[model samples]
Target chain A: MKNRIVILGVLLALGFSAQAQKYFTRDARVQFNSDTPVEKIEAVNKSGTSVLDTQTGRMDWKVLIKNFLFEKALMQEHFNENYMESTKYPNATFKGSITNLQDVNFAKDGTYKVTAKGAMTIHGVEQEITVPGTLTVGGGAVKVKADFVVKPADYKIDIPGVVRDNIAKEIAVTIDASLKPMGK
Target chain B: MLKKIVLFLAVAGVIGAGIGYYMFNKKVPSMASEKSEVTIEAAQLYQEFEADEAAASAKYVGKIVAVSGTVLEASALEDGTPKVLLDTGSDFGVSCEFDPNTKHAKTTFTPGEKLTLKGECAGINLDVQLARCVVVQ
Candidate 1:
């Protein structure tokens, strides 16, 4: 009977580990807006990924810079060649823990305000940032929405004097992500 | 005095015309097609690669470019070709395929030398998502 109990315990442990709530999205959309009277430009990175660990309240995200597309082709080229230097610095990432993780109940359908504090790395510079976001959890799916600002000089991105007025010193970034259960 | 004034005005007009001609006819460096290609530092290039691999690779395609980064991994091709993997210090890294015939390919770069490579942007692998590269230098 003891051996059978031990076997049952092992199976229960495996089942709990398998059911650990982890969510991910490969198609997370991150957009950056730089508005100036000279040029109102918006760029979107369509191929970003965000991973959410419910058990630990840890969140990880990565986005490719080259994928960020602009409406004008010339502007796109200028962005890669001149501004972001896509060939030189290609990705941005965030790794942080959700401060209000316990407040979110993934099993229930509801909207919860979440505060995530983590290090955001961009243009080869890493900065610690706290971002507040709204998470919608329902039907085995999760959606995240957040907006924040980052300074260009902080990342060592030098805007040339000629077009410095056109690009803002602080860029506004918005994130809208949909995540699914890892195995699913 | 009227004649002198007319002469002065004509000379001024001639000088103005000459200056205009110089301005229009003299070679002004064209920002486009000038091939003012600058070798991007390896660390910077890697950062760009990490941001957007496909878009970054597409932007540099068919251009004379130079990039520097650390060597991540290097290996030999089945056809006796040598390949080098470079980490641009960014999330996006690239594998450079060198022509086996080149002497420099035999021995020029080592891992973590912050190598600056000059090459024609060959294009990228959209399928496997590898940084498609060919060595020019």
Candidate 2:
């Protein structure tokens, strides 16, 4: 009886460990919108990569700055040449963790609302941020969704006085990713 | 004579302003309509990126490139957008993001399929990224 109980405990530990593996996505969608009374500017990037470890509650995301596409060609050029300076800082990244890991059950197939805190770096500047998000685990996949706000001034992005009114100080950002098991 | 000089200056200024306005508003052509700036294999591009990212970016960034390679993976996004990944002998490879508006009906690129893609290089992270990709062959 003692040996059988020990074997059962080991099997349970292995099963739980397997569920703690990392999940990732190569094409995470990240969109940003700047809506002011005078103007509305927005861009979308679908080539962002993100990784999440369910056990450690850690997550990381990386996106190339040049991948953000705008509707207007001139706006795209101004974004890369004048504002974000994509040549100097080609990538934006976020490294953080899910603060509410205890509230999430990875094995369950349901949507869990959670908060994540991390440092987001853009244009060579890093800022600590906490964002509310949804994590859905279903069909052997993990999907994450989050909405947050970012300030251009915080990243030292300078807008010319002529176009200052055309852009907003705070930009609304949205992220959605459907991650697969690692090494898949 | 002064009046003629002022009139000439005013006319030149107006023409210049008009041209400036037109240029300012001009948008880049869609990738499907534009010509590829350069043609290279996916492996070569990946090698260059891995060798020196800055050098590779200087050569490929903002330019339309035509890359031919074998498709290692093809998947549709949650919103039904099609994406393809080419082999690069690394943990990560080149990911091509296609125009979501295009109809890819009945066309699926499975692994080990040969394809040529033209798009703008978006620089490298874990993989060399391309956007607005259109399949040529």
Candidate 3:
């Protein structure tokens, strides 16, 4: 009986530890740039959340639209109020899983290509996209970097003809994130 | 008559230039600075809070300051507490939690708006890993 109880306790502890292993970052930054006479605009989402599941190779990210910043304050306002309509559609989320999960060994230091395919919702439109990126695992940490293009129309973001050329039809997005162990 | 036409053209050009200047250079009236205020970059403020929430809270508590950043996420807590994430291009963000009873809390800001927030710095949340925030934007 004593041995059986000890085994049960060990199993419970393992389960708890596994649950705690899930890593997340709320400070993920996604930036986009367009070159028109070399004018650069940038925005950051401070409340972005990226979650990774080691056991299942699943990852998820969510961000709010009103969080993007442009050097010109007017541009920023128009983005949220007119372009993104963030008040109506406040949040964007990506639900995807890493395909090369098995290739990553978090305990070792190496770089691996990670393929994430999932539904991304922006501007109240959801589309399926596959994002391929590099993931570096080392020092008990994971870092991811990827760059991809997203069509505004694909996500139902309608830009009026008057300013259509001001914004790109296809916006290039870049993501570079690093994640540390959740707890000591 | 040709001279009159040229005069009208010149007047129209002047009017057009004036309109263009107003649109491009005129600052919004409501944006006028009310008082001398300290402006801190969003990234620096976020790092300060992340490095030590308690210490940051003590240093900035009850001080009126302005921070500018991109809105990362905004949502209501389980108990209907409104919260916003301010990202400064870093891995950690400052979470602004507003009082439910505040008038502005009913409706003001939303996600994705680059905002300059002026507020009294509250404490940080150790459990949720967030910098406790109030709103003065």
The ten-residue window of minimal lDDT in model 3 chain A covers A38-47
What ranking emerges by TM-score with the best candidate at the front?
2, 3, 1
User: Residue B122's C-alpha lDDT in candidate 3?
Assistant: 33
**Superposing all C-alpha atoms, what RMSD in Å does each candidate have to the true structure?**
13.9, 6.1, 12.6
- DockQ for every model, please: 0.03, 0.59, 0.07
lDDT of 2 by residue, A1-184 (tens): 9999999999998767856498988889999999988877889898889989898889999999999988777888999999999999999999999999999999999999999999999999999999999999999999999999899999999999999999998899999999989865
Q: Model 2: clashing residue pairs?
A: none
As a TM-score, model 1 comes out at 0.56
* Candidate 1 chain B: 10-residue stretch with minimal lDDT: B123-132
lDDT of each: 0.68, 0.89, 0.66
TM-score of 2: 0.87
Candidate 3: residue A163 Cα off by (Å): 1.4
Report the lDDT tens digits of candidate 2 across residue range B1-137: 99999999999999999998887667655677768999999999999999999899999998999999999999877666678999987877888888644444334789999899888999987889888888885
Across B38-74, the per-residue lDDT of candidate 1 in tens digits comes to 4775555555545686675666644556666667656
What are the per-model numbers of colliding residue pairs?
A: 22, 0, 10
lDDT of 3 by residue, A1-184 (tens): 9999999999998767676667776556677875454345566544466877777777888775655544554776677778788656756788998887888887788998989999999999999999999888886778878888888889878889877667776688888777666644
